[model samples]
Target: MSDASPAPVTAAILVIGDEILSGRTKDKNIGYIAEYLTNSGIDLREVRVVPDVAEEIVAAVNALRTRYTYLFTTGGIGPTHDDITADCVAQAVGVGIDVDPRARAMLLERIKPEDLNEARLRMARIPFGAELIENPISKAPGFMIENVIVMAGVPSIMQAMMDSVAPRLKTGARVTAETIEAGNLPEGGYAEGLAVIAKAHPGVSIGSYPSMTPAGFRNQIVVRGREPEALAAARTEIEALLARLQAERT
Candidate 1:
């Protein structure tokens, strides 16, 4: 038979804001975007949080856009001097930046022509040869310059923009995940065996996560892969290992 399909498409997230680094504003967008991309068959591989500096933004955009299938940038696309992400994106792509008529029309939906001040009009600036990602919640649309998509910092607006662009993006096989719940088990006991299983099944990824909850400490071994059979095999190996260890303790 033909070989199984390749891994899911890859992506990276670039978070830009001074408030985030300063701890003044706790970030709520990264987790949301990570989960969203996971469900959309896009593997979010790298995440970077940079200050609202034009040079930093440009550098990150250049780096991530080249390294991944898609690059998602959140924050710095607002209506203030710190909102310099749009210009940075333009500069990164080596393209002239200007207020696009389409983007201006989107903003006009919320702001009247007379009230469209310069600060608000700044939202309409987009890089040359970029596509607008619609924001249903807010009239200020996000933009996609080639593979690098620039989005708002607000969680609601970023989610809306993602919904709009997801349909148009090229998606790959959805990565499936399996979790084996271990009750208060020490990760040290199974770390070596899990490593062996991981090496045996090169196609799958196995990770052990330990968390503390109100009830007590809990551990979970999560296996992720594209193939169901391979995933099941790895999970079986993990379960058997756990059973043997439990029996030995008893």
Candidate 2:
């Protein structure tokens, strides 16, 4: 049997909006999308947030789409003047965008035909030759053109769109993680030993997270990797190091 693993599937997120950049509207989508991608076996390598400027949006879209296996964008598809993400994505992909009838139909489901004015029609604009991503919440559909997936900025709608597109994505080996509860153990006590084990494993990623509670400070050491054998070996070493340090304190 062959031992070679499949090539990793990677993605990046591009958040567009003046509101997000100005701190007027706090972004809650990045973390959600990051976790979603990770669970789907797609590694989220980078995230970039840009304002409503067309040039900046286009530049960022072009850069990230080329760098990763897929690029996801949120925000700027609303019915306001600042909503230019669809246009920017079209420009970056060198395609013309127009009001897609299918998208208009989706809007019509939630909006009265008489109420579907120009402002509402803005949500129907989609890049040419793109597949629509269903939005169960608001019914304003997102779109996928080649490797770029565009969705609404709202947390609920974006999450729905992510679920809509999940099945179609190319996925790689899922990453597994093991966490060791170090209790009050200080990171400095095992930083060097942890670093050495991390270097030796190479495939596993080791991280120490500290949190505070009413009782005292608590620390957790996490080991993550795609290979089970490598992950197990790293976790064993980390546990031994922590135990040695605890014994020294006695």
Candidate 3:
């Protein structure tokens, strides 16, 4: 028999900002990134929220980039005192960060010379050999190094950068998911039967998501697989099992 390949392409997201940790800002990028990656066949394995400290940012960037197929970082790239993601990333990779000419040219086109002072110049610094990720909402560009994609903290700019980067990412075979709802059925009641069904379809993954209510508990069984045929077959088997379980309950 041939060897089994990896199940899914995986990615990690790092959200860097003092505002997030301080509760001054609620993070909205992780959900957006997770959804975007999942739809493109990239499994989101991990998410991290770190403060604007350089050491923390560097450590997170180093670890995630090494462990995941792709790493996406949002926030900490602005012109403020806390904007340190670029420098931290450079330190993480042992590369010197400097003002990028391409980024400067782009910035110059949009920002006046007087506006390109120290505060604004902070936005142009990029890790050596990194490519720019376009930000349509603002002139400041994000940069990508190896598999790490750095993006703006602002939602609109982050979305635009994602649009620019999504097409170029490598994707494995897409995983298809099917769900069946068992209304008002306690998950424990069907656990054994579901186990049998899961054993029979070992290639497909089955999960029981349960929610509690004032009346009782309900469950939603989700089956996921790379092969559509396998997923469909597993779904049918699960539905049959659910039907049998329901009859037994009533």
Candidate 4:
């Protein structure tokens, strides 16, 4: 029997905007996209936030699109002069960009023909030979070229774009996780044991998260893996380690 597993599907996110880089517009799309990708069986491996500069956007688009199975970019696709994501993506993928007829038709759904001036037409610009992603909230559509998926900067619009593009994406085995609560347990106390468990279970990822509560420090150890058996085994070891430490403290 062939025991080789299928290649893992991975993705990266490029958040483009000067406002995000300057902290003026706090990004909400990254977290939403991460969770959405996770649930869809695609791992979000890397996230990069760059300014509105064309060079930076193009460089990030090229680098990320080549490295991962898919690259999702949010921001810079708007009506203003600063919305240059579409042009940068075209440059990165070595394709010519112009106002797509299909996209223009979509824009016409919400915008009057007379009001469809230069700036609004910018939203209709798409890379050549790329497919359009529907924006149900607004008429301005996002586009996908090669492995790069362009989206809006606004959280609501970006979320809607995700729904439109998700069905077409390639996916892999969905990762599952088990969380073990270590009440008032210091991470320092069980760090070594947790590391040992993590090393033993090569297929599973173990992480210890510590949070401050009104009672005291609360620690959560999460074991994540695609295989149910591996996750359960790791969770068992983690729970045992926590119990041993708690017993020793008493």
Candidate 5:
């Protein structure tokens, strides 16, 4: 292993909505955030799904923002009556929410002055000193306050915001992953040997995924490492172990 320090980046995703908790709507932000963070070389350490309760939202936002290097929140910031993410986040960060001049100008560019009613005006309310995150699909913008970045709940808007914001975030050395598929092997049968192999390589992470096949069952073992040399060495050992185990079974 290299003596270099590990990347200094961590992130967390907060999915907020009563609909998701009630199973009326499936949450999609977690997967998107996880993949995006991984690709950006930020370790996604935690994910939380909370109902649209003011106290819960405030608590979660406070806790996550303080703990992680970056906190991304989705949902509960719309124009509807239930939308309280902005207010909660404002309270969490000890900032006052007001109609931001930049946000109002951005919204006014797309929507007519007559259409800008109280409900629509709510969209312009953001925490003090927050920077706007561009939304290409819709005129409504997301905001970044301190370490926390808030975005839309809709998948398309979230993705667009991520595309715009990714280049600005700090990145670290990316972790590399490799996989080996062992056809028709039972996980229970190979668990002992796999454990031995795992023990031998402390720096590599190995996981076994079992699946059903037309012939019988299959097992896939994935090995991941940050260093190429360590990763290749670990894969060689894992392949040899798998070959020996297969030979024994046959």
Candidate 6:
């Protein structure tokens, strides 16, 4: 084991479901989880939405689980036939999958044992040697196999599971952000200058976001980093660049 704590723990979100890809269901879990991870000092580096296909889910799980420190997957863990996240995760990790008794007991708390049919039993299926993530809203729990965390697609349930799992995760220093509003400044005019500023402050993450405000088009440059000093310096440089652009616009 390393003596020191890791500086930045990065993560990725894998959203699975054909309904999501088809635009039938609006994804609320991704944003919630991303913000949740950010607040917990874990950087959400990437997000990918894949269909419910087993091969695709397995592939995405394997790929992301290796790339980031944690991979949180939402969707396809339900009573329905399409809910195949548990099995897919098992296949990806090369582990045997089966109905976990603990999960069945949790399910029984809400559902009667005699009433537990095939569909309900599907929720009990978990990969070997995986830990359960609590879902207070609904008794059905999600599982964590290695770094990949499987959660319910329903936004509220997913949120609860995330809260339960958050404490157990290895978190790093929270990333701090400073946003500077460049009123009426066109991104095209400041793009090059912004790039230069970004390069100058390699320690901080700098980016320009152009939005259509009621006042018209406005740009905001946001500088994010774990170090307070780095954020201050980047913000100062960005402010200077915006001032110069404003002067030229006049």
Which candidate number maximizes lDDT? 2
Q: 1-250 in candidate 3: lDDT tens per residue?
A: 8688765789999999889999999888889988888789898899999998888899999999999899999998998888999999989988899889889887898899887998888999999989899877777999999889999988989999999988889988777788899887788788898898889888898999988878777789999888787888888988888898789878
- Candidate 3 Cα outliers beyond 4 Å, as residue runs: 1-3, 199-202, 211-217
TM-scores of the candidates are 0.96, 0.97, 0.92, 0.98, 0.94, 0.94
Q: Write the per-residue lDDT of candidate 6 for residues 1-250, one digit (tens) a residue.
A: 8765466799999999999999999999888998998899998999999998999999999999999999999999999989999999999999998899999999988988789999999999999999999877879999998998999999999988988898889988888988899988778888998899889888899888889978788888888998798899889988998888788878
- Report lDDT (CA) for all predictions: 0.91, 0.94, 0.89, 0.93, 0.87, 0.90
lDDT by residue (tens digit), candidate 5, 147-215: 888999999899999987887788887778888987777787778887987888877888999887687
Report model 3's TM-score to 2 decimal places: 0.92
List, residue by residue over 1-250, the lDDT tens digit for candidate 1: 9776765689999999999999999999999989888888889999999998888899999999999999999998888998999999999999998889999999999888999999998999988999999988878989998898889999889988888888878888788998998777799988899899999999898989999999999999999998899999999999999998888888
Q: How accurate is candidate 1 locally (lDDT)?
A: 0.91
TM-score of 1: 0.96
- C-alpha displacement of 133 in model 4, angstroms? 0.4
**Residue pairs in collision within model 5:** none
Candidate 2: what lDDT? Answer: 0.94
How badly does each model clash, as a count of residue pairs?
Answer: 0, 0, 0, 0, 0, 0
lDDT, residue 102, candidate 2: 99
Give, for candidate 1, the lowest lDDT window spanning 10 residues.
1-10
The 10-residue segment with the lowest total lDDT in model 5: 182-191
Question: Which order, best to worst by TM-score?
Answer: 4, 2, 1, 5, 6, 3
- State the TM-score for model 2: 0.97
Q: Which of 3 and 4 is ahead in TM-score?
A: 4
Please identify which of the two predictions, 3 or 4, would achieve the higher lDDT against the true structure.
4
Q: Is candidate 2 or candidate 3 better by TM-score?
A: 2
Could you tell which candidate, 1 or 4, scores higher by TM-score? 4
